[model samples]
Target chain A: MPPRKPASKDPEPLPRSARKDLTRAKLLQAALTLMGEGRSFTSLGLREIAREAGLVPNAFYRHFRNTDELGLVLVEDVGITLRRLLREARKMDVAPRDMLRRSVSVYLEYVKLNRLQFLFISSERSGGSRILRLAIRNDVTHFTNEMAQDFRIRGLYAQLPTASLQMVCGMIVMTMLAAATDVLDLPPDQPLLEAEMSENFVQQLKIILFGATRLNDALTRS
Target chain B: MPPRKPASKDPEPLPRSARKDLTRAKLLQAALTLMGEGRSFTSLGLREIAREAGLVPNAFYRHFRNTDELGLVLVEDVGITLRRLLREARKMDVAPRDMLRRSVSVYLEYVKLNRLQFLFISSERSGGSRILRLAIRNDVTHFTNEMAQDFRIRGLYAQLPTASLQMVCGMIVMTMLAAATDVLDLPPDQPLLEAEMSENFVQQLKIILFGATRLNDALTRS
Candidate 1:
């Protein structure tokens, strides 16, 4: 058979740096796929991940020295994802007219949009992997701190002292994570269940905000 | 060597039903032990659990048809544990002074006493095994409902309607579960970190209670 001619529609090969980035992303996606399939983060093997990425075992080393490093990078990616979320939240109007419900809607949509990554973090955050658990915990604490900073910047809960505000933010963050478990586990196409869950989520956050507003006064009275 | 003889302090054998109960408990405990070791509930096997319990595989078959069945039983046990905790909380004085702190201290101590069980539930509640996840979720729902009932009986949050009261209890239960993750992971013998964590836990519960009290008014205005 004669040699096949190249298709004119084919684009030029990407540059070396860009191709490397593509391969790195492939490895990360492979890990997420495995985790999204319900495998614990601690149980993942490097060779298996490389195979899943359709690359040679040696290629895995080019992107990450080991699985733990890859795990850390995944967590770092989660940190960025959370920061981006906070940034989106900042863009929303701070006027408290049904703001909590709107934020919950946006956040739940985000959780569904990035379902696999959230699955990985939630499972590994408390799973058997000490390294992953601690890394995820660090990211959560950073997220909580940024939330407190956001509240300060927006002048919400202004009466709360810095420590008290931080504590309140921590509770809010915990509530968000807890709601995520339900959000991730929710069955598909069940609008009624989804509404009930969202309503519950909204009420929970409202309670926390109201609690923060009264805590300072209550402490003073005591 | 001379034939082995029963020790002088050895008591008579337990009845057959009691002996069966002992083996059943052992099998349940073996699952918790494996989960506490970082193995996902979905990854545990019947033979492996039986071996961990120092029992024959047949003994495991007598107790549970599969690992998932054993997992459901463990979830049921958690329900009983939660009920016992509520009973103890009920016994505490109904006065408002420092009650939240006292309840938190008792709950944290209870978590420490049942570290492996909490580890199993926390890890499996959102982990790979769908069956175990659902079962744990059910038990948690039961715990939340019972908490609401107790609140009604005790006249706490008396003005709130039943539906609102139940939602408040759900949020409280979620907070308790989140705190369990931290309490289970806490490093041993660190008084400072433990106190700090416990204080944060108290603040979170306080916020929830305060939020519950004012939620009705907030809703009416809206």
Candidate 2:
């Protein structure tokens, strides 16, 4: 099969297409929630997702070419969701520490809400349909590039090259990926709530940010 | 179907049992190699893994109840491997920084040699297998407890409790996992060659250690 195309835009949204898009969105949303509950996209069937969305199995094809294609959509959805959270969270005039605390909460909440999608994206690097994997890598690259721009704009990473910024972003994202999952048995649904898990996250962020900031400090000291 | 039990201990290591255990180990080893190639565990099948191990499909059942069960075993194996690496690495008579650098190199080399198992464990939790997910969590707890004991014996974590030490271990494992998996896409297997990745790892460790040390120092000064 030809590589599945991402949802295309039309100058004017057709009701039929809009409905299909809505159905697709709903399926993705349901999948994300299911993932949060610990379902894998590989094992998740299109029929089950459609059933969750209260649609017939045939209706799923109207949106996604197949389940693997839907997984790509889900991966893209996670990127969009996370970016949206970052954007909205950025609007708050809080200290970086406070913002990070809030961000952790928001991040966990996103995982809880879209568990399946978050897990799906998290696991994408491992065995998955080829198309889905590429989409995930694309999302990672896009997000990294986006963050470089954000950090540059804020002057936080003004001295760093895009590569270093990407490394920092990669580290942060990877740490968060570990945090977002229950692999650590953190003794809390959201580690941000547990004093221990939350403190660890705070310190982990501090260590990462400190390392980034200090790299600049070292360069200046030299 | 009932959950599969791992192999039993025997003095002589029965021919069939030993053979089953070796096949499982071989499959895991094969998975690790495949992981370096960027394949996730979910995308792989039993037949392929068994075939890779020069065994027939039915022979796989003698080892694992299913691929997910095999994934759980892989997680356990990774924890053991990592803990062994830390133990062996720490025994080297060198500067802490140099020791750490070499440790990372060893880690990368190990992953390069055992790609499938590492990738399987890394991808398991997010891949939505209950057994694998729980196994990863349990192994993490096991690792944290081990780290906490080591820290206590060395009196290294006086400033932090065992819980906090475990969290630190969790964060370090997260960073290591990220580094090992090529999640950063460091020029496609370039993390091993790039002095920067190991340098960053050491720097991050220093920041964690010294940052906490300095916090205590500052408190004393204040």
Candidate 3:
């Protein structure tokens, strides 16, 4: 989140793989930087991305075959970012009285910390190339499945059937993505509005969780 | 929904207002057509849209000052379509079993019926111009408020606080929009998949509804 650590600060020559990783990261950052500057992913050209990355155009081919290939890598990064957020949330104290609210706070912080990635996913998830949209959808499904798995592993909503639990997680993920959109668009330096949105977000997730429990109860009774 | 009824079938001279309305509709349709062809709203130019609408560039100004204004009008149309869906859902027999499923069915049908409009909003909502993004967000909020109001008027979720009720509706609206994106992307003639998606949709909405009730109980006890 803090600009990611540089691969190295010393002048000592790094391993070949390390250098490749750094250049790959640079190309990815170049793409995100362009998108951050109001360019849609589809509008980006490989030459410009390479130029932005301070590499020759030929360097672009060392990483991606085309812009769409680069776009897919960005989507993959979004997937990783999402999984990281989930991992962070999993680290929170589940016994806390307001764990949900705390989780929302943590999630918003991560969203802000990784604003460009969230913005990229939010915009592309519903609005861009078919390949990218489907890719984002697949990652979202993965996220929702991981969430459902977490709930089960924690014995939360354990009574719900697998199908119902997944549905509930899907709803939760939808709410989270919607909140991310809000987080990305949030006006800078507006704590009051930010708090209000966070509270609203927590309440929305509560509705899904409680609703899943209620459904499980009804199924058990019937 | 059935392509909208023709204003007249007669050979008589049309009223001036009627002609103006028809031309405006053409311009709106042209914009949608362009977006449906995978063009982002921000990328559309006045000349291209006018040409697409079979009008001179001058006629474009008669309907919209620029493409952004036209985009705003499209957002307005999306609002109307959403409200109409709500109205249709209201007419459903609430006492019947699985009313949520019925509503989702009707809603998905509407989404498919107005595929272009849904596609327009889905893309522009967060992906394009700031103006269009904000406009769509405003309409979505309006749709959420209207949903909350309808619940209140009908005595649904009668016990939840107004703020909580609105938040619940916001979740529900969020789910609906997410489902719309699914609906818009659904492959042609896959009834099995469509039904599966519809069932998933109903389950998601039910979770929110039941969740809201559970929260209301908790709040009351607290």
The per-model DockQ list reads 0.55, 0.33, 0.57
Error of 1 at B65 (Å): 3.3
Off by over 4 Å in 3: A1-23, A55-62, B1-24, B38-48, B55-63, B219-222
Over 4 Å off, model 2: A1-14, A33-37, A51-59, A94-103, A106-116, A125-127, A157-162, A182-195, B1-39, B43-64, B94-97, B151-158, B183-203, B216-222
Model 1 clashing residue pairs (backbone): none
TM-score versus the correct structure, for each prediction:
0.87, 0.76, 0.86
Top candidate (DockQ) = 3
Q: lDDT at A118 for candidate 3? A: 90
DockQ ranking, best first: 3, 1, 2
* Residue-level lDDT tens digits of model 3 in A169-197: 88878888889889778878899999899
State which candidate has the highest TM-score.
Answer: 1
Q: Return the TM-score for chain B, candidate 3.
A: 0.87
Worst lDDT run of 10 residues, candidate 2 chain B, spans: B2-11
Give per-residue CA lDDT, model 3, range B1-222, as digits (tens): 344556466555789999999989998888889888877676688999999999999999888888889888888888898888878777874658866676788888888999999888888787877888989999999988998998899888788889998998888887888888887778779999888888888888888878888877777788
Q: Could you give the interface RMSD of candidate 1 in angstroms? A: 2.1
Across A1-222, the per-residue lDDT of candidate 2 in tens digits comes to 534543464445568877667767798777766655656667778889888888889988878888887777677677887688668656764466577777776666666676555656766654466677668878776776676677777788567767777777776766776666553334445534554555666677766776677666776676
Tens-place lDDT per residue, model 1, B76-134, is 88888888888888899677888888889989999988888888888777765677777
